[model samples]
Target: MMMRPPLVEVRGMTKRFGALTALDDVSLRLAPGAFHAILGENGAGKSTLVKCMMGYHRADAGRLLVDGQEHQVAGPRGAHHLGFGMVYQHFTLVPSMTVAENLILGRDDLPAVVAWAAERERMEAFLRRMPFRVDLDRAAGALAAGEKQKIEILKQLFLGRRVLILDEPTSVLTPDEADQILGVLRTMAREGQVTVVLITHKFREVEAFAHEVTVLRAGRRIGGGHVKDLTRGDLVAMMIPPMLAVEALTVLDDKALTAVRELSLAVGAGEILGVAGVSGNGQRELVETLAGQRSPEAGLIRVAGERYRPTRRQMRRRRVFVLPEEPLSNACVRTMTIAENLAFRNFDEPPIAVTGGFLSRRALHDRGRELIDRFKIRAAGPDASLDTLSGGNVQRTVLARELSQSPKVLVAQNPCAGLDVAATAEIRGRIMAARNAGAAVLFLSEDLDELMELADRIVVMFEGRLVYETARAAADPHVIGHSMASHL
Candidate 1:
């Protein structure tokens, strides 16, 4: 018996931008019906490699082969024509269109005449053949994040795409939803229906679903093999390090009186350090100082062992994101569209910003739609003004922006304060997920119960000082309350 040729292959692929080499001589092979995972930190060239394959970017060097034949992919359309499809981190569906309409919307042979009955019949049969089902008549915008993601995959399949590339598909999903989606994909791979290529930073997903893995670092493929052959330590060694520390930090309030005095704390990677306090116990000042709203009077802030300032550039570069107390007043611009507000974080970055510093309105709207679905924010549409959204929806918008970055250091101040029970649960789950993914979380809240439930450690804040500290396992509410009222 002869071995089968790889369904997709890249040899000596390289991409460059100006003086920077985004991808350097990277190679990949995907077997038919196989599940492959690409793991990397930000800027590790994972996106560059995929873009080259999808023809979104013309590689500076190397060859792309589909079914052992070389092909020059001109763009996404060309790639799609070659049976390749990509599900981006953002949804591409038209909100007002029904699921059936969106599924057939991309067809080159779409009919101009009446054919709803025939299309619905065809869609019904298509859903029956799949592992899951979605209501065809339902508007795409009305679907949840997990459901929207499923539609994305189903849309590709409906278009007859045999090879699927998914970029962080589970980033916005809850754990159960993530599991369900990945499980379905895994089963599909096992049944030889499609080949799946996953781009993610999650080792748990890779360990559970992927058969083969490739690790990228600094624009180069560093290590890869069968998933069973690798250990967590092996993958961690290939990646990088991260943490957050504040040493002897001091801040002053509006009267220039000391509000945070000689405060110090460290949040290790994958750890949550909760600051427990009453409303006026220096929590606001500490949060403002961390968020760059107020300058510290003294002391040092460090991220990953390097001196840090919370300038926009530094915050973005270091992956330090914040979810402040009052998102509507502090975070969003009331007059701007939801899409425009969501783009605030990456408006100047690529994909969102085309050449010559012009913003891509389509990209902004697409990203906003994605987050809106994921965060379950009830709104008219991405074009809706921020002021039109309710208080909870506004908070969800801010949560979507900050947590979506997968921050290394998350500075959250009463993130769940005004949210409903369900929304609060969602926000807390996202925060915990971020911490579990190796983020250092600095959580400041007045709710002791919330702190005890989610924090790895707790510290009491009173009169501008951390008066008491204890591991969560050993925390005593009475003791902590006493400390919060009177420094001990």
Candidate 2:
């Protein structure tokens, strides 16, 4: 028997952005009609590689071979014409459009003659073949996350794409939703309809669905093999670098309307307390209360030896900082200069402002320059607008400013959410460093793998209650997942 060539292949691929080499001499191959997984930390070149494949970013070097033939794909259209399609983490559907209309988008093959009745029937028939039914006349925008994801796949299949790439497809979905979407993809692959490439951070995703796995670290391929041949530890070791850990600090959050109820836990002074739960499971409320963005309707809060509602002045005086999700909007001012954003905490005091309460530009820039260097922020200079930098750089700026204050309590919500492999590592390292320096860190994330790696102790939030608590050593994904979905 002869071996079939990969449906897609990249050889010696390299991509660079200014002085940064995002991808270097990376290569990968995907077999036809198979479910393959690309695993890496943020900045690990997974997105870069996907971009290269989608023709979003043409490689600076190397060749992209498709079906045993070398071709230079000019852009997304070319990739689409070459039988490739990608479903991003965010939905690309038009909310106003009907399911049938959305599915027909970008199609150049529609007949010149009008036949709305027949087209509707055809669309309905097409949807029937899917594992789940989606009403053709229903508004796409009104659909659930799982439905939208299925629509993405259906659109690809409708377009005759032989290769489908899903980038963190399950990031925003519940466990059951994830299972449903991926289950449909698995069925698609099993039926020899399309080759699937799952780009994700979860090991369980790969174990459950992917037949083969490829690991990338810092722009290079570190490991590749059959999923069965790799152990859970093997994947973890490849993904998580090294980190520092710390002592414990305690927190108690009693009730509210459908939020946390009597949630009391302790995180040491030099420890990372990981909070895990399906989204909307009081994690948001806990984070908000800790950040002082919202006052607890009724509960006692204690941290850094203080027992009271943490006001802005109190939080700043106590050196408590928060790295909220979507830092560009929540943690920063887009119109402001990087220097000004960095000086937000200390703008009224010395080094950033004069004793007479005058804004000192020179002092601020000097301090900003120091932090930019320390945090490896890739900005033109301290004077550059925050809007000009990438997501990772914006996050770095946020971390730089917060950590520079030498905070005693650090509250981070999905700090590494949309970052690449390198940036994620850097942020995690900074969190660990803060812990090592005696900061009590409360880390909340939907990413189980991340929580498992960095946390000294872990807890789960479900229906406004702390349902499960355990040391990191005993934090099993299966157990945590079970507790996450449980109402009791």
The top-ranked prediction according to lDDT is 1
Overall lDDT per candidate, in order of appearance: 0.88, 0.82
Q: Model 2, 1-488: lDDT tens per residue?
A: 11222478889999999998999998888878789999998989999998998999989998988888999988998888778889999999889998888888846466676477987777767666667677788899899988898888888777667788999999989999999889878877877777899999999999999989999877888887899999997786566532211112123334435476666665556778888888877776677777776666555666533464568887787778889888987889999999999988888888667777688899989988999999999999999999999999999999998899788888899999989999999999999999989888889888999999999888887876777888898778999989889954
**Per-residue error at 329 for model 1, in Å?**
1.3
lDDT of 1 at 254: 94
Provide the lowest-lDDT 10-residue window in model 2. 242-251
Model 1 residue 113 CA deviation (Å) reads 99
After TM-score superposition, the amount by which residue 224's alpha carbon in candidate 2 deviates from its true location, in angstroms, is 2.0
Q: Which residues of candidate 1, in runs, are more than 4 Å off?
A: 1-242
Q: What is the C-alpha RMSD of each candidate to the true structure, in Å?
A: 18.7, 20.4
TM-score of each: 0.52, 0.50
Per-residue lDDT tens digits for candidate 1, residues 1-488, read 11222489999999999999999999999988889999999888998999988889999999988888999988988888778888888899999999988999877567887498988887788888898789888999999999999999999888888788999899989999989999998988888888899999999999999999989877899889999999987787565433887899999999999999998887878989999998987888898888889999899998986799999999999999998888887888999999888878899998899998898888888999999998888999999999999887888888888888889999999999877898889889999999999899999998999999999999998988888899999999999988888877
Global lDDT of model 2: 0.82
Task: Output the lDDT of residue 431, model 2.
Answer: 94
